[model samples]
Target: MSESSDGAKDPSAGTLYPGESPRVYRALFNIFPPYLFGGVRVRHIADDWTSVRVTYTVRPWNRNNPNRAAFGGTLYSMTDPFFGIMAYGQLGRDYRVWNTVGNIEFIAPGRGTVTAIMELSREQVDAIRDATRDGGKSITDHAAEIRDMQGNLVARASQKLYARRLRR
Candidate 1:
């Protein structure tokens, strides 16, 4: 069994090479409805599933606010899928992971394009693995700060996911 950076066995490695399926998944997910409708674009998905970046562009129809800012809904929508998707990719099919909770805080009016970076560190992954090793589920929370082109904070989002090992 191949070991991940966190020293957990890669349960799906026998079928898919590292980063193979998820790369395709990331590509296809970019055009999915929530992202397409919100004018959100995925900038990148790192090979190891450690980092994913998303960008949102302000479009005319989506902006009706006084300042013509990017809709807060769009900002929130751009972040909706990352945590769940990343968890599935990282944990593979051997682990059942679901995004159980979510929330967003608008920090400022967003104009032009904004980016959100979601990262899952090895330490965090390891902690989750430890928590779920006893066959019970674990809830893990991840957060990201969305920033404007000028690197100013535009929003803060948190996602909580439930993960547990699957039985054959």
Candidate 2:
């Protein structure tokens, strides 16, 4: 776990600082222990931390469901960390961010490998900054879709985040 080149700390479980290479954030995410055990791999992330793609393969340990489908818990868990992580990265060090709410709907049973992509657009980031610029906190909702290898939607999740600037 190296710090970003801009000397920005990744807020414990966070991403590289602005102007820092995307590779550093990717490396930190790839080696995350829960991701490794869950077979969830981050496929890509835009340099500005606006978007992230992740893939999860069902393994024997995680296939303990009665139908041998990917466990709903694992599906939910895979989407859990990305939002707050991304916000902290893009919002910079002067702010505090936390992934406060998560809800998932299992649309279809998932077998084999699956993928979920989480993205926070530049406009959205700007909105958050604007909403919180006065040091007031903001709570916002974000969504991600988890699809199976066949391009079928298996689950959808809504994650709400809390963000506010640290009062000096």
Candidate 3:
């Protein structure tokens, strides 16, 4: 029940203990092809979380603002779609999962190569499985953040997943 600076439950505490193996993170990257941006590379992944760091190059489509910065939508789109994937991966085959809804906040223009980190807890995973098993309906909420190479917050996303226990 660790809490974040915002006073909500800390998302990374249980799923990723300190110094966990990188192999686990690599496996998570494979689960969601959508999160794998064409040029993005996963610098580190651990616990039940993954982080993708982007390397920038000059591209006409990426330049949206007068400053020749990365388009805000491009930045957000790059940051999206990973939380639900990680949540389902953590839940394993015990339940069927799908993204239901999401909300995003863009804090600053993405100027350089960026990073998106997604995480979920073991308790959250179990709750989704149990809720679906017991009530036939499960709604789970998860969050993620995108940051710049220097670790400045660039975008935040919150996701809701609808899950159901698969009938064998």
Candidate 3 global lDDT? 0.58
- Give the runs in model 2 whose Cα sits over 4 Å from its true position: 1-21
Global CA lDDT computed for model 2: 0.79
In the range 50-85, model 3's lDDT, one tens digit per residue, is 333333332455466486666655565554555555
- Model 3 residue 40 CA deviation (Å) reads 2.7
- Candidate 3, residue 152: how far the Cα is off, in Å: 2.3
The model with the greatest lDDT is 2
Ranking by lDDT: 2, 1, 3
Per-residue lDDT for 36-133 in model 2, tens only? 77787888877777788888899778775688888888888777877877787777777788887889999998889999999887667667777886
lDDT (Cα, 0-100) at 132 in candidate 3: 65
Q: Give the Cα RMSD of candidate 3.
A: 8.2
Q: What tens-digit string does per-residue lDDT give for candidate 1 at 48-165?
A: 7778898988878666468799887788777777776666666666787778898999889888899999998656766776787678898988899999999999999988988897
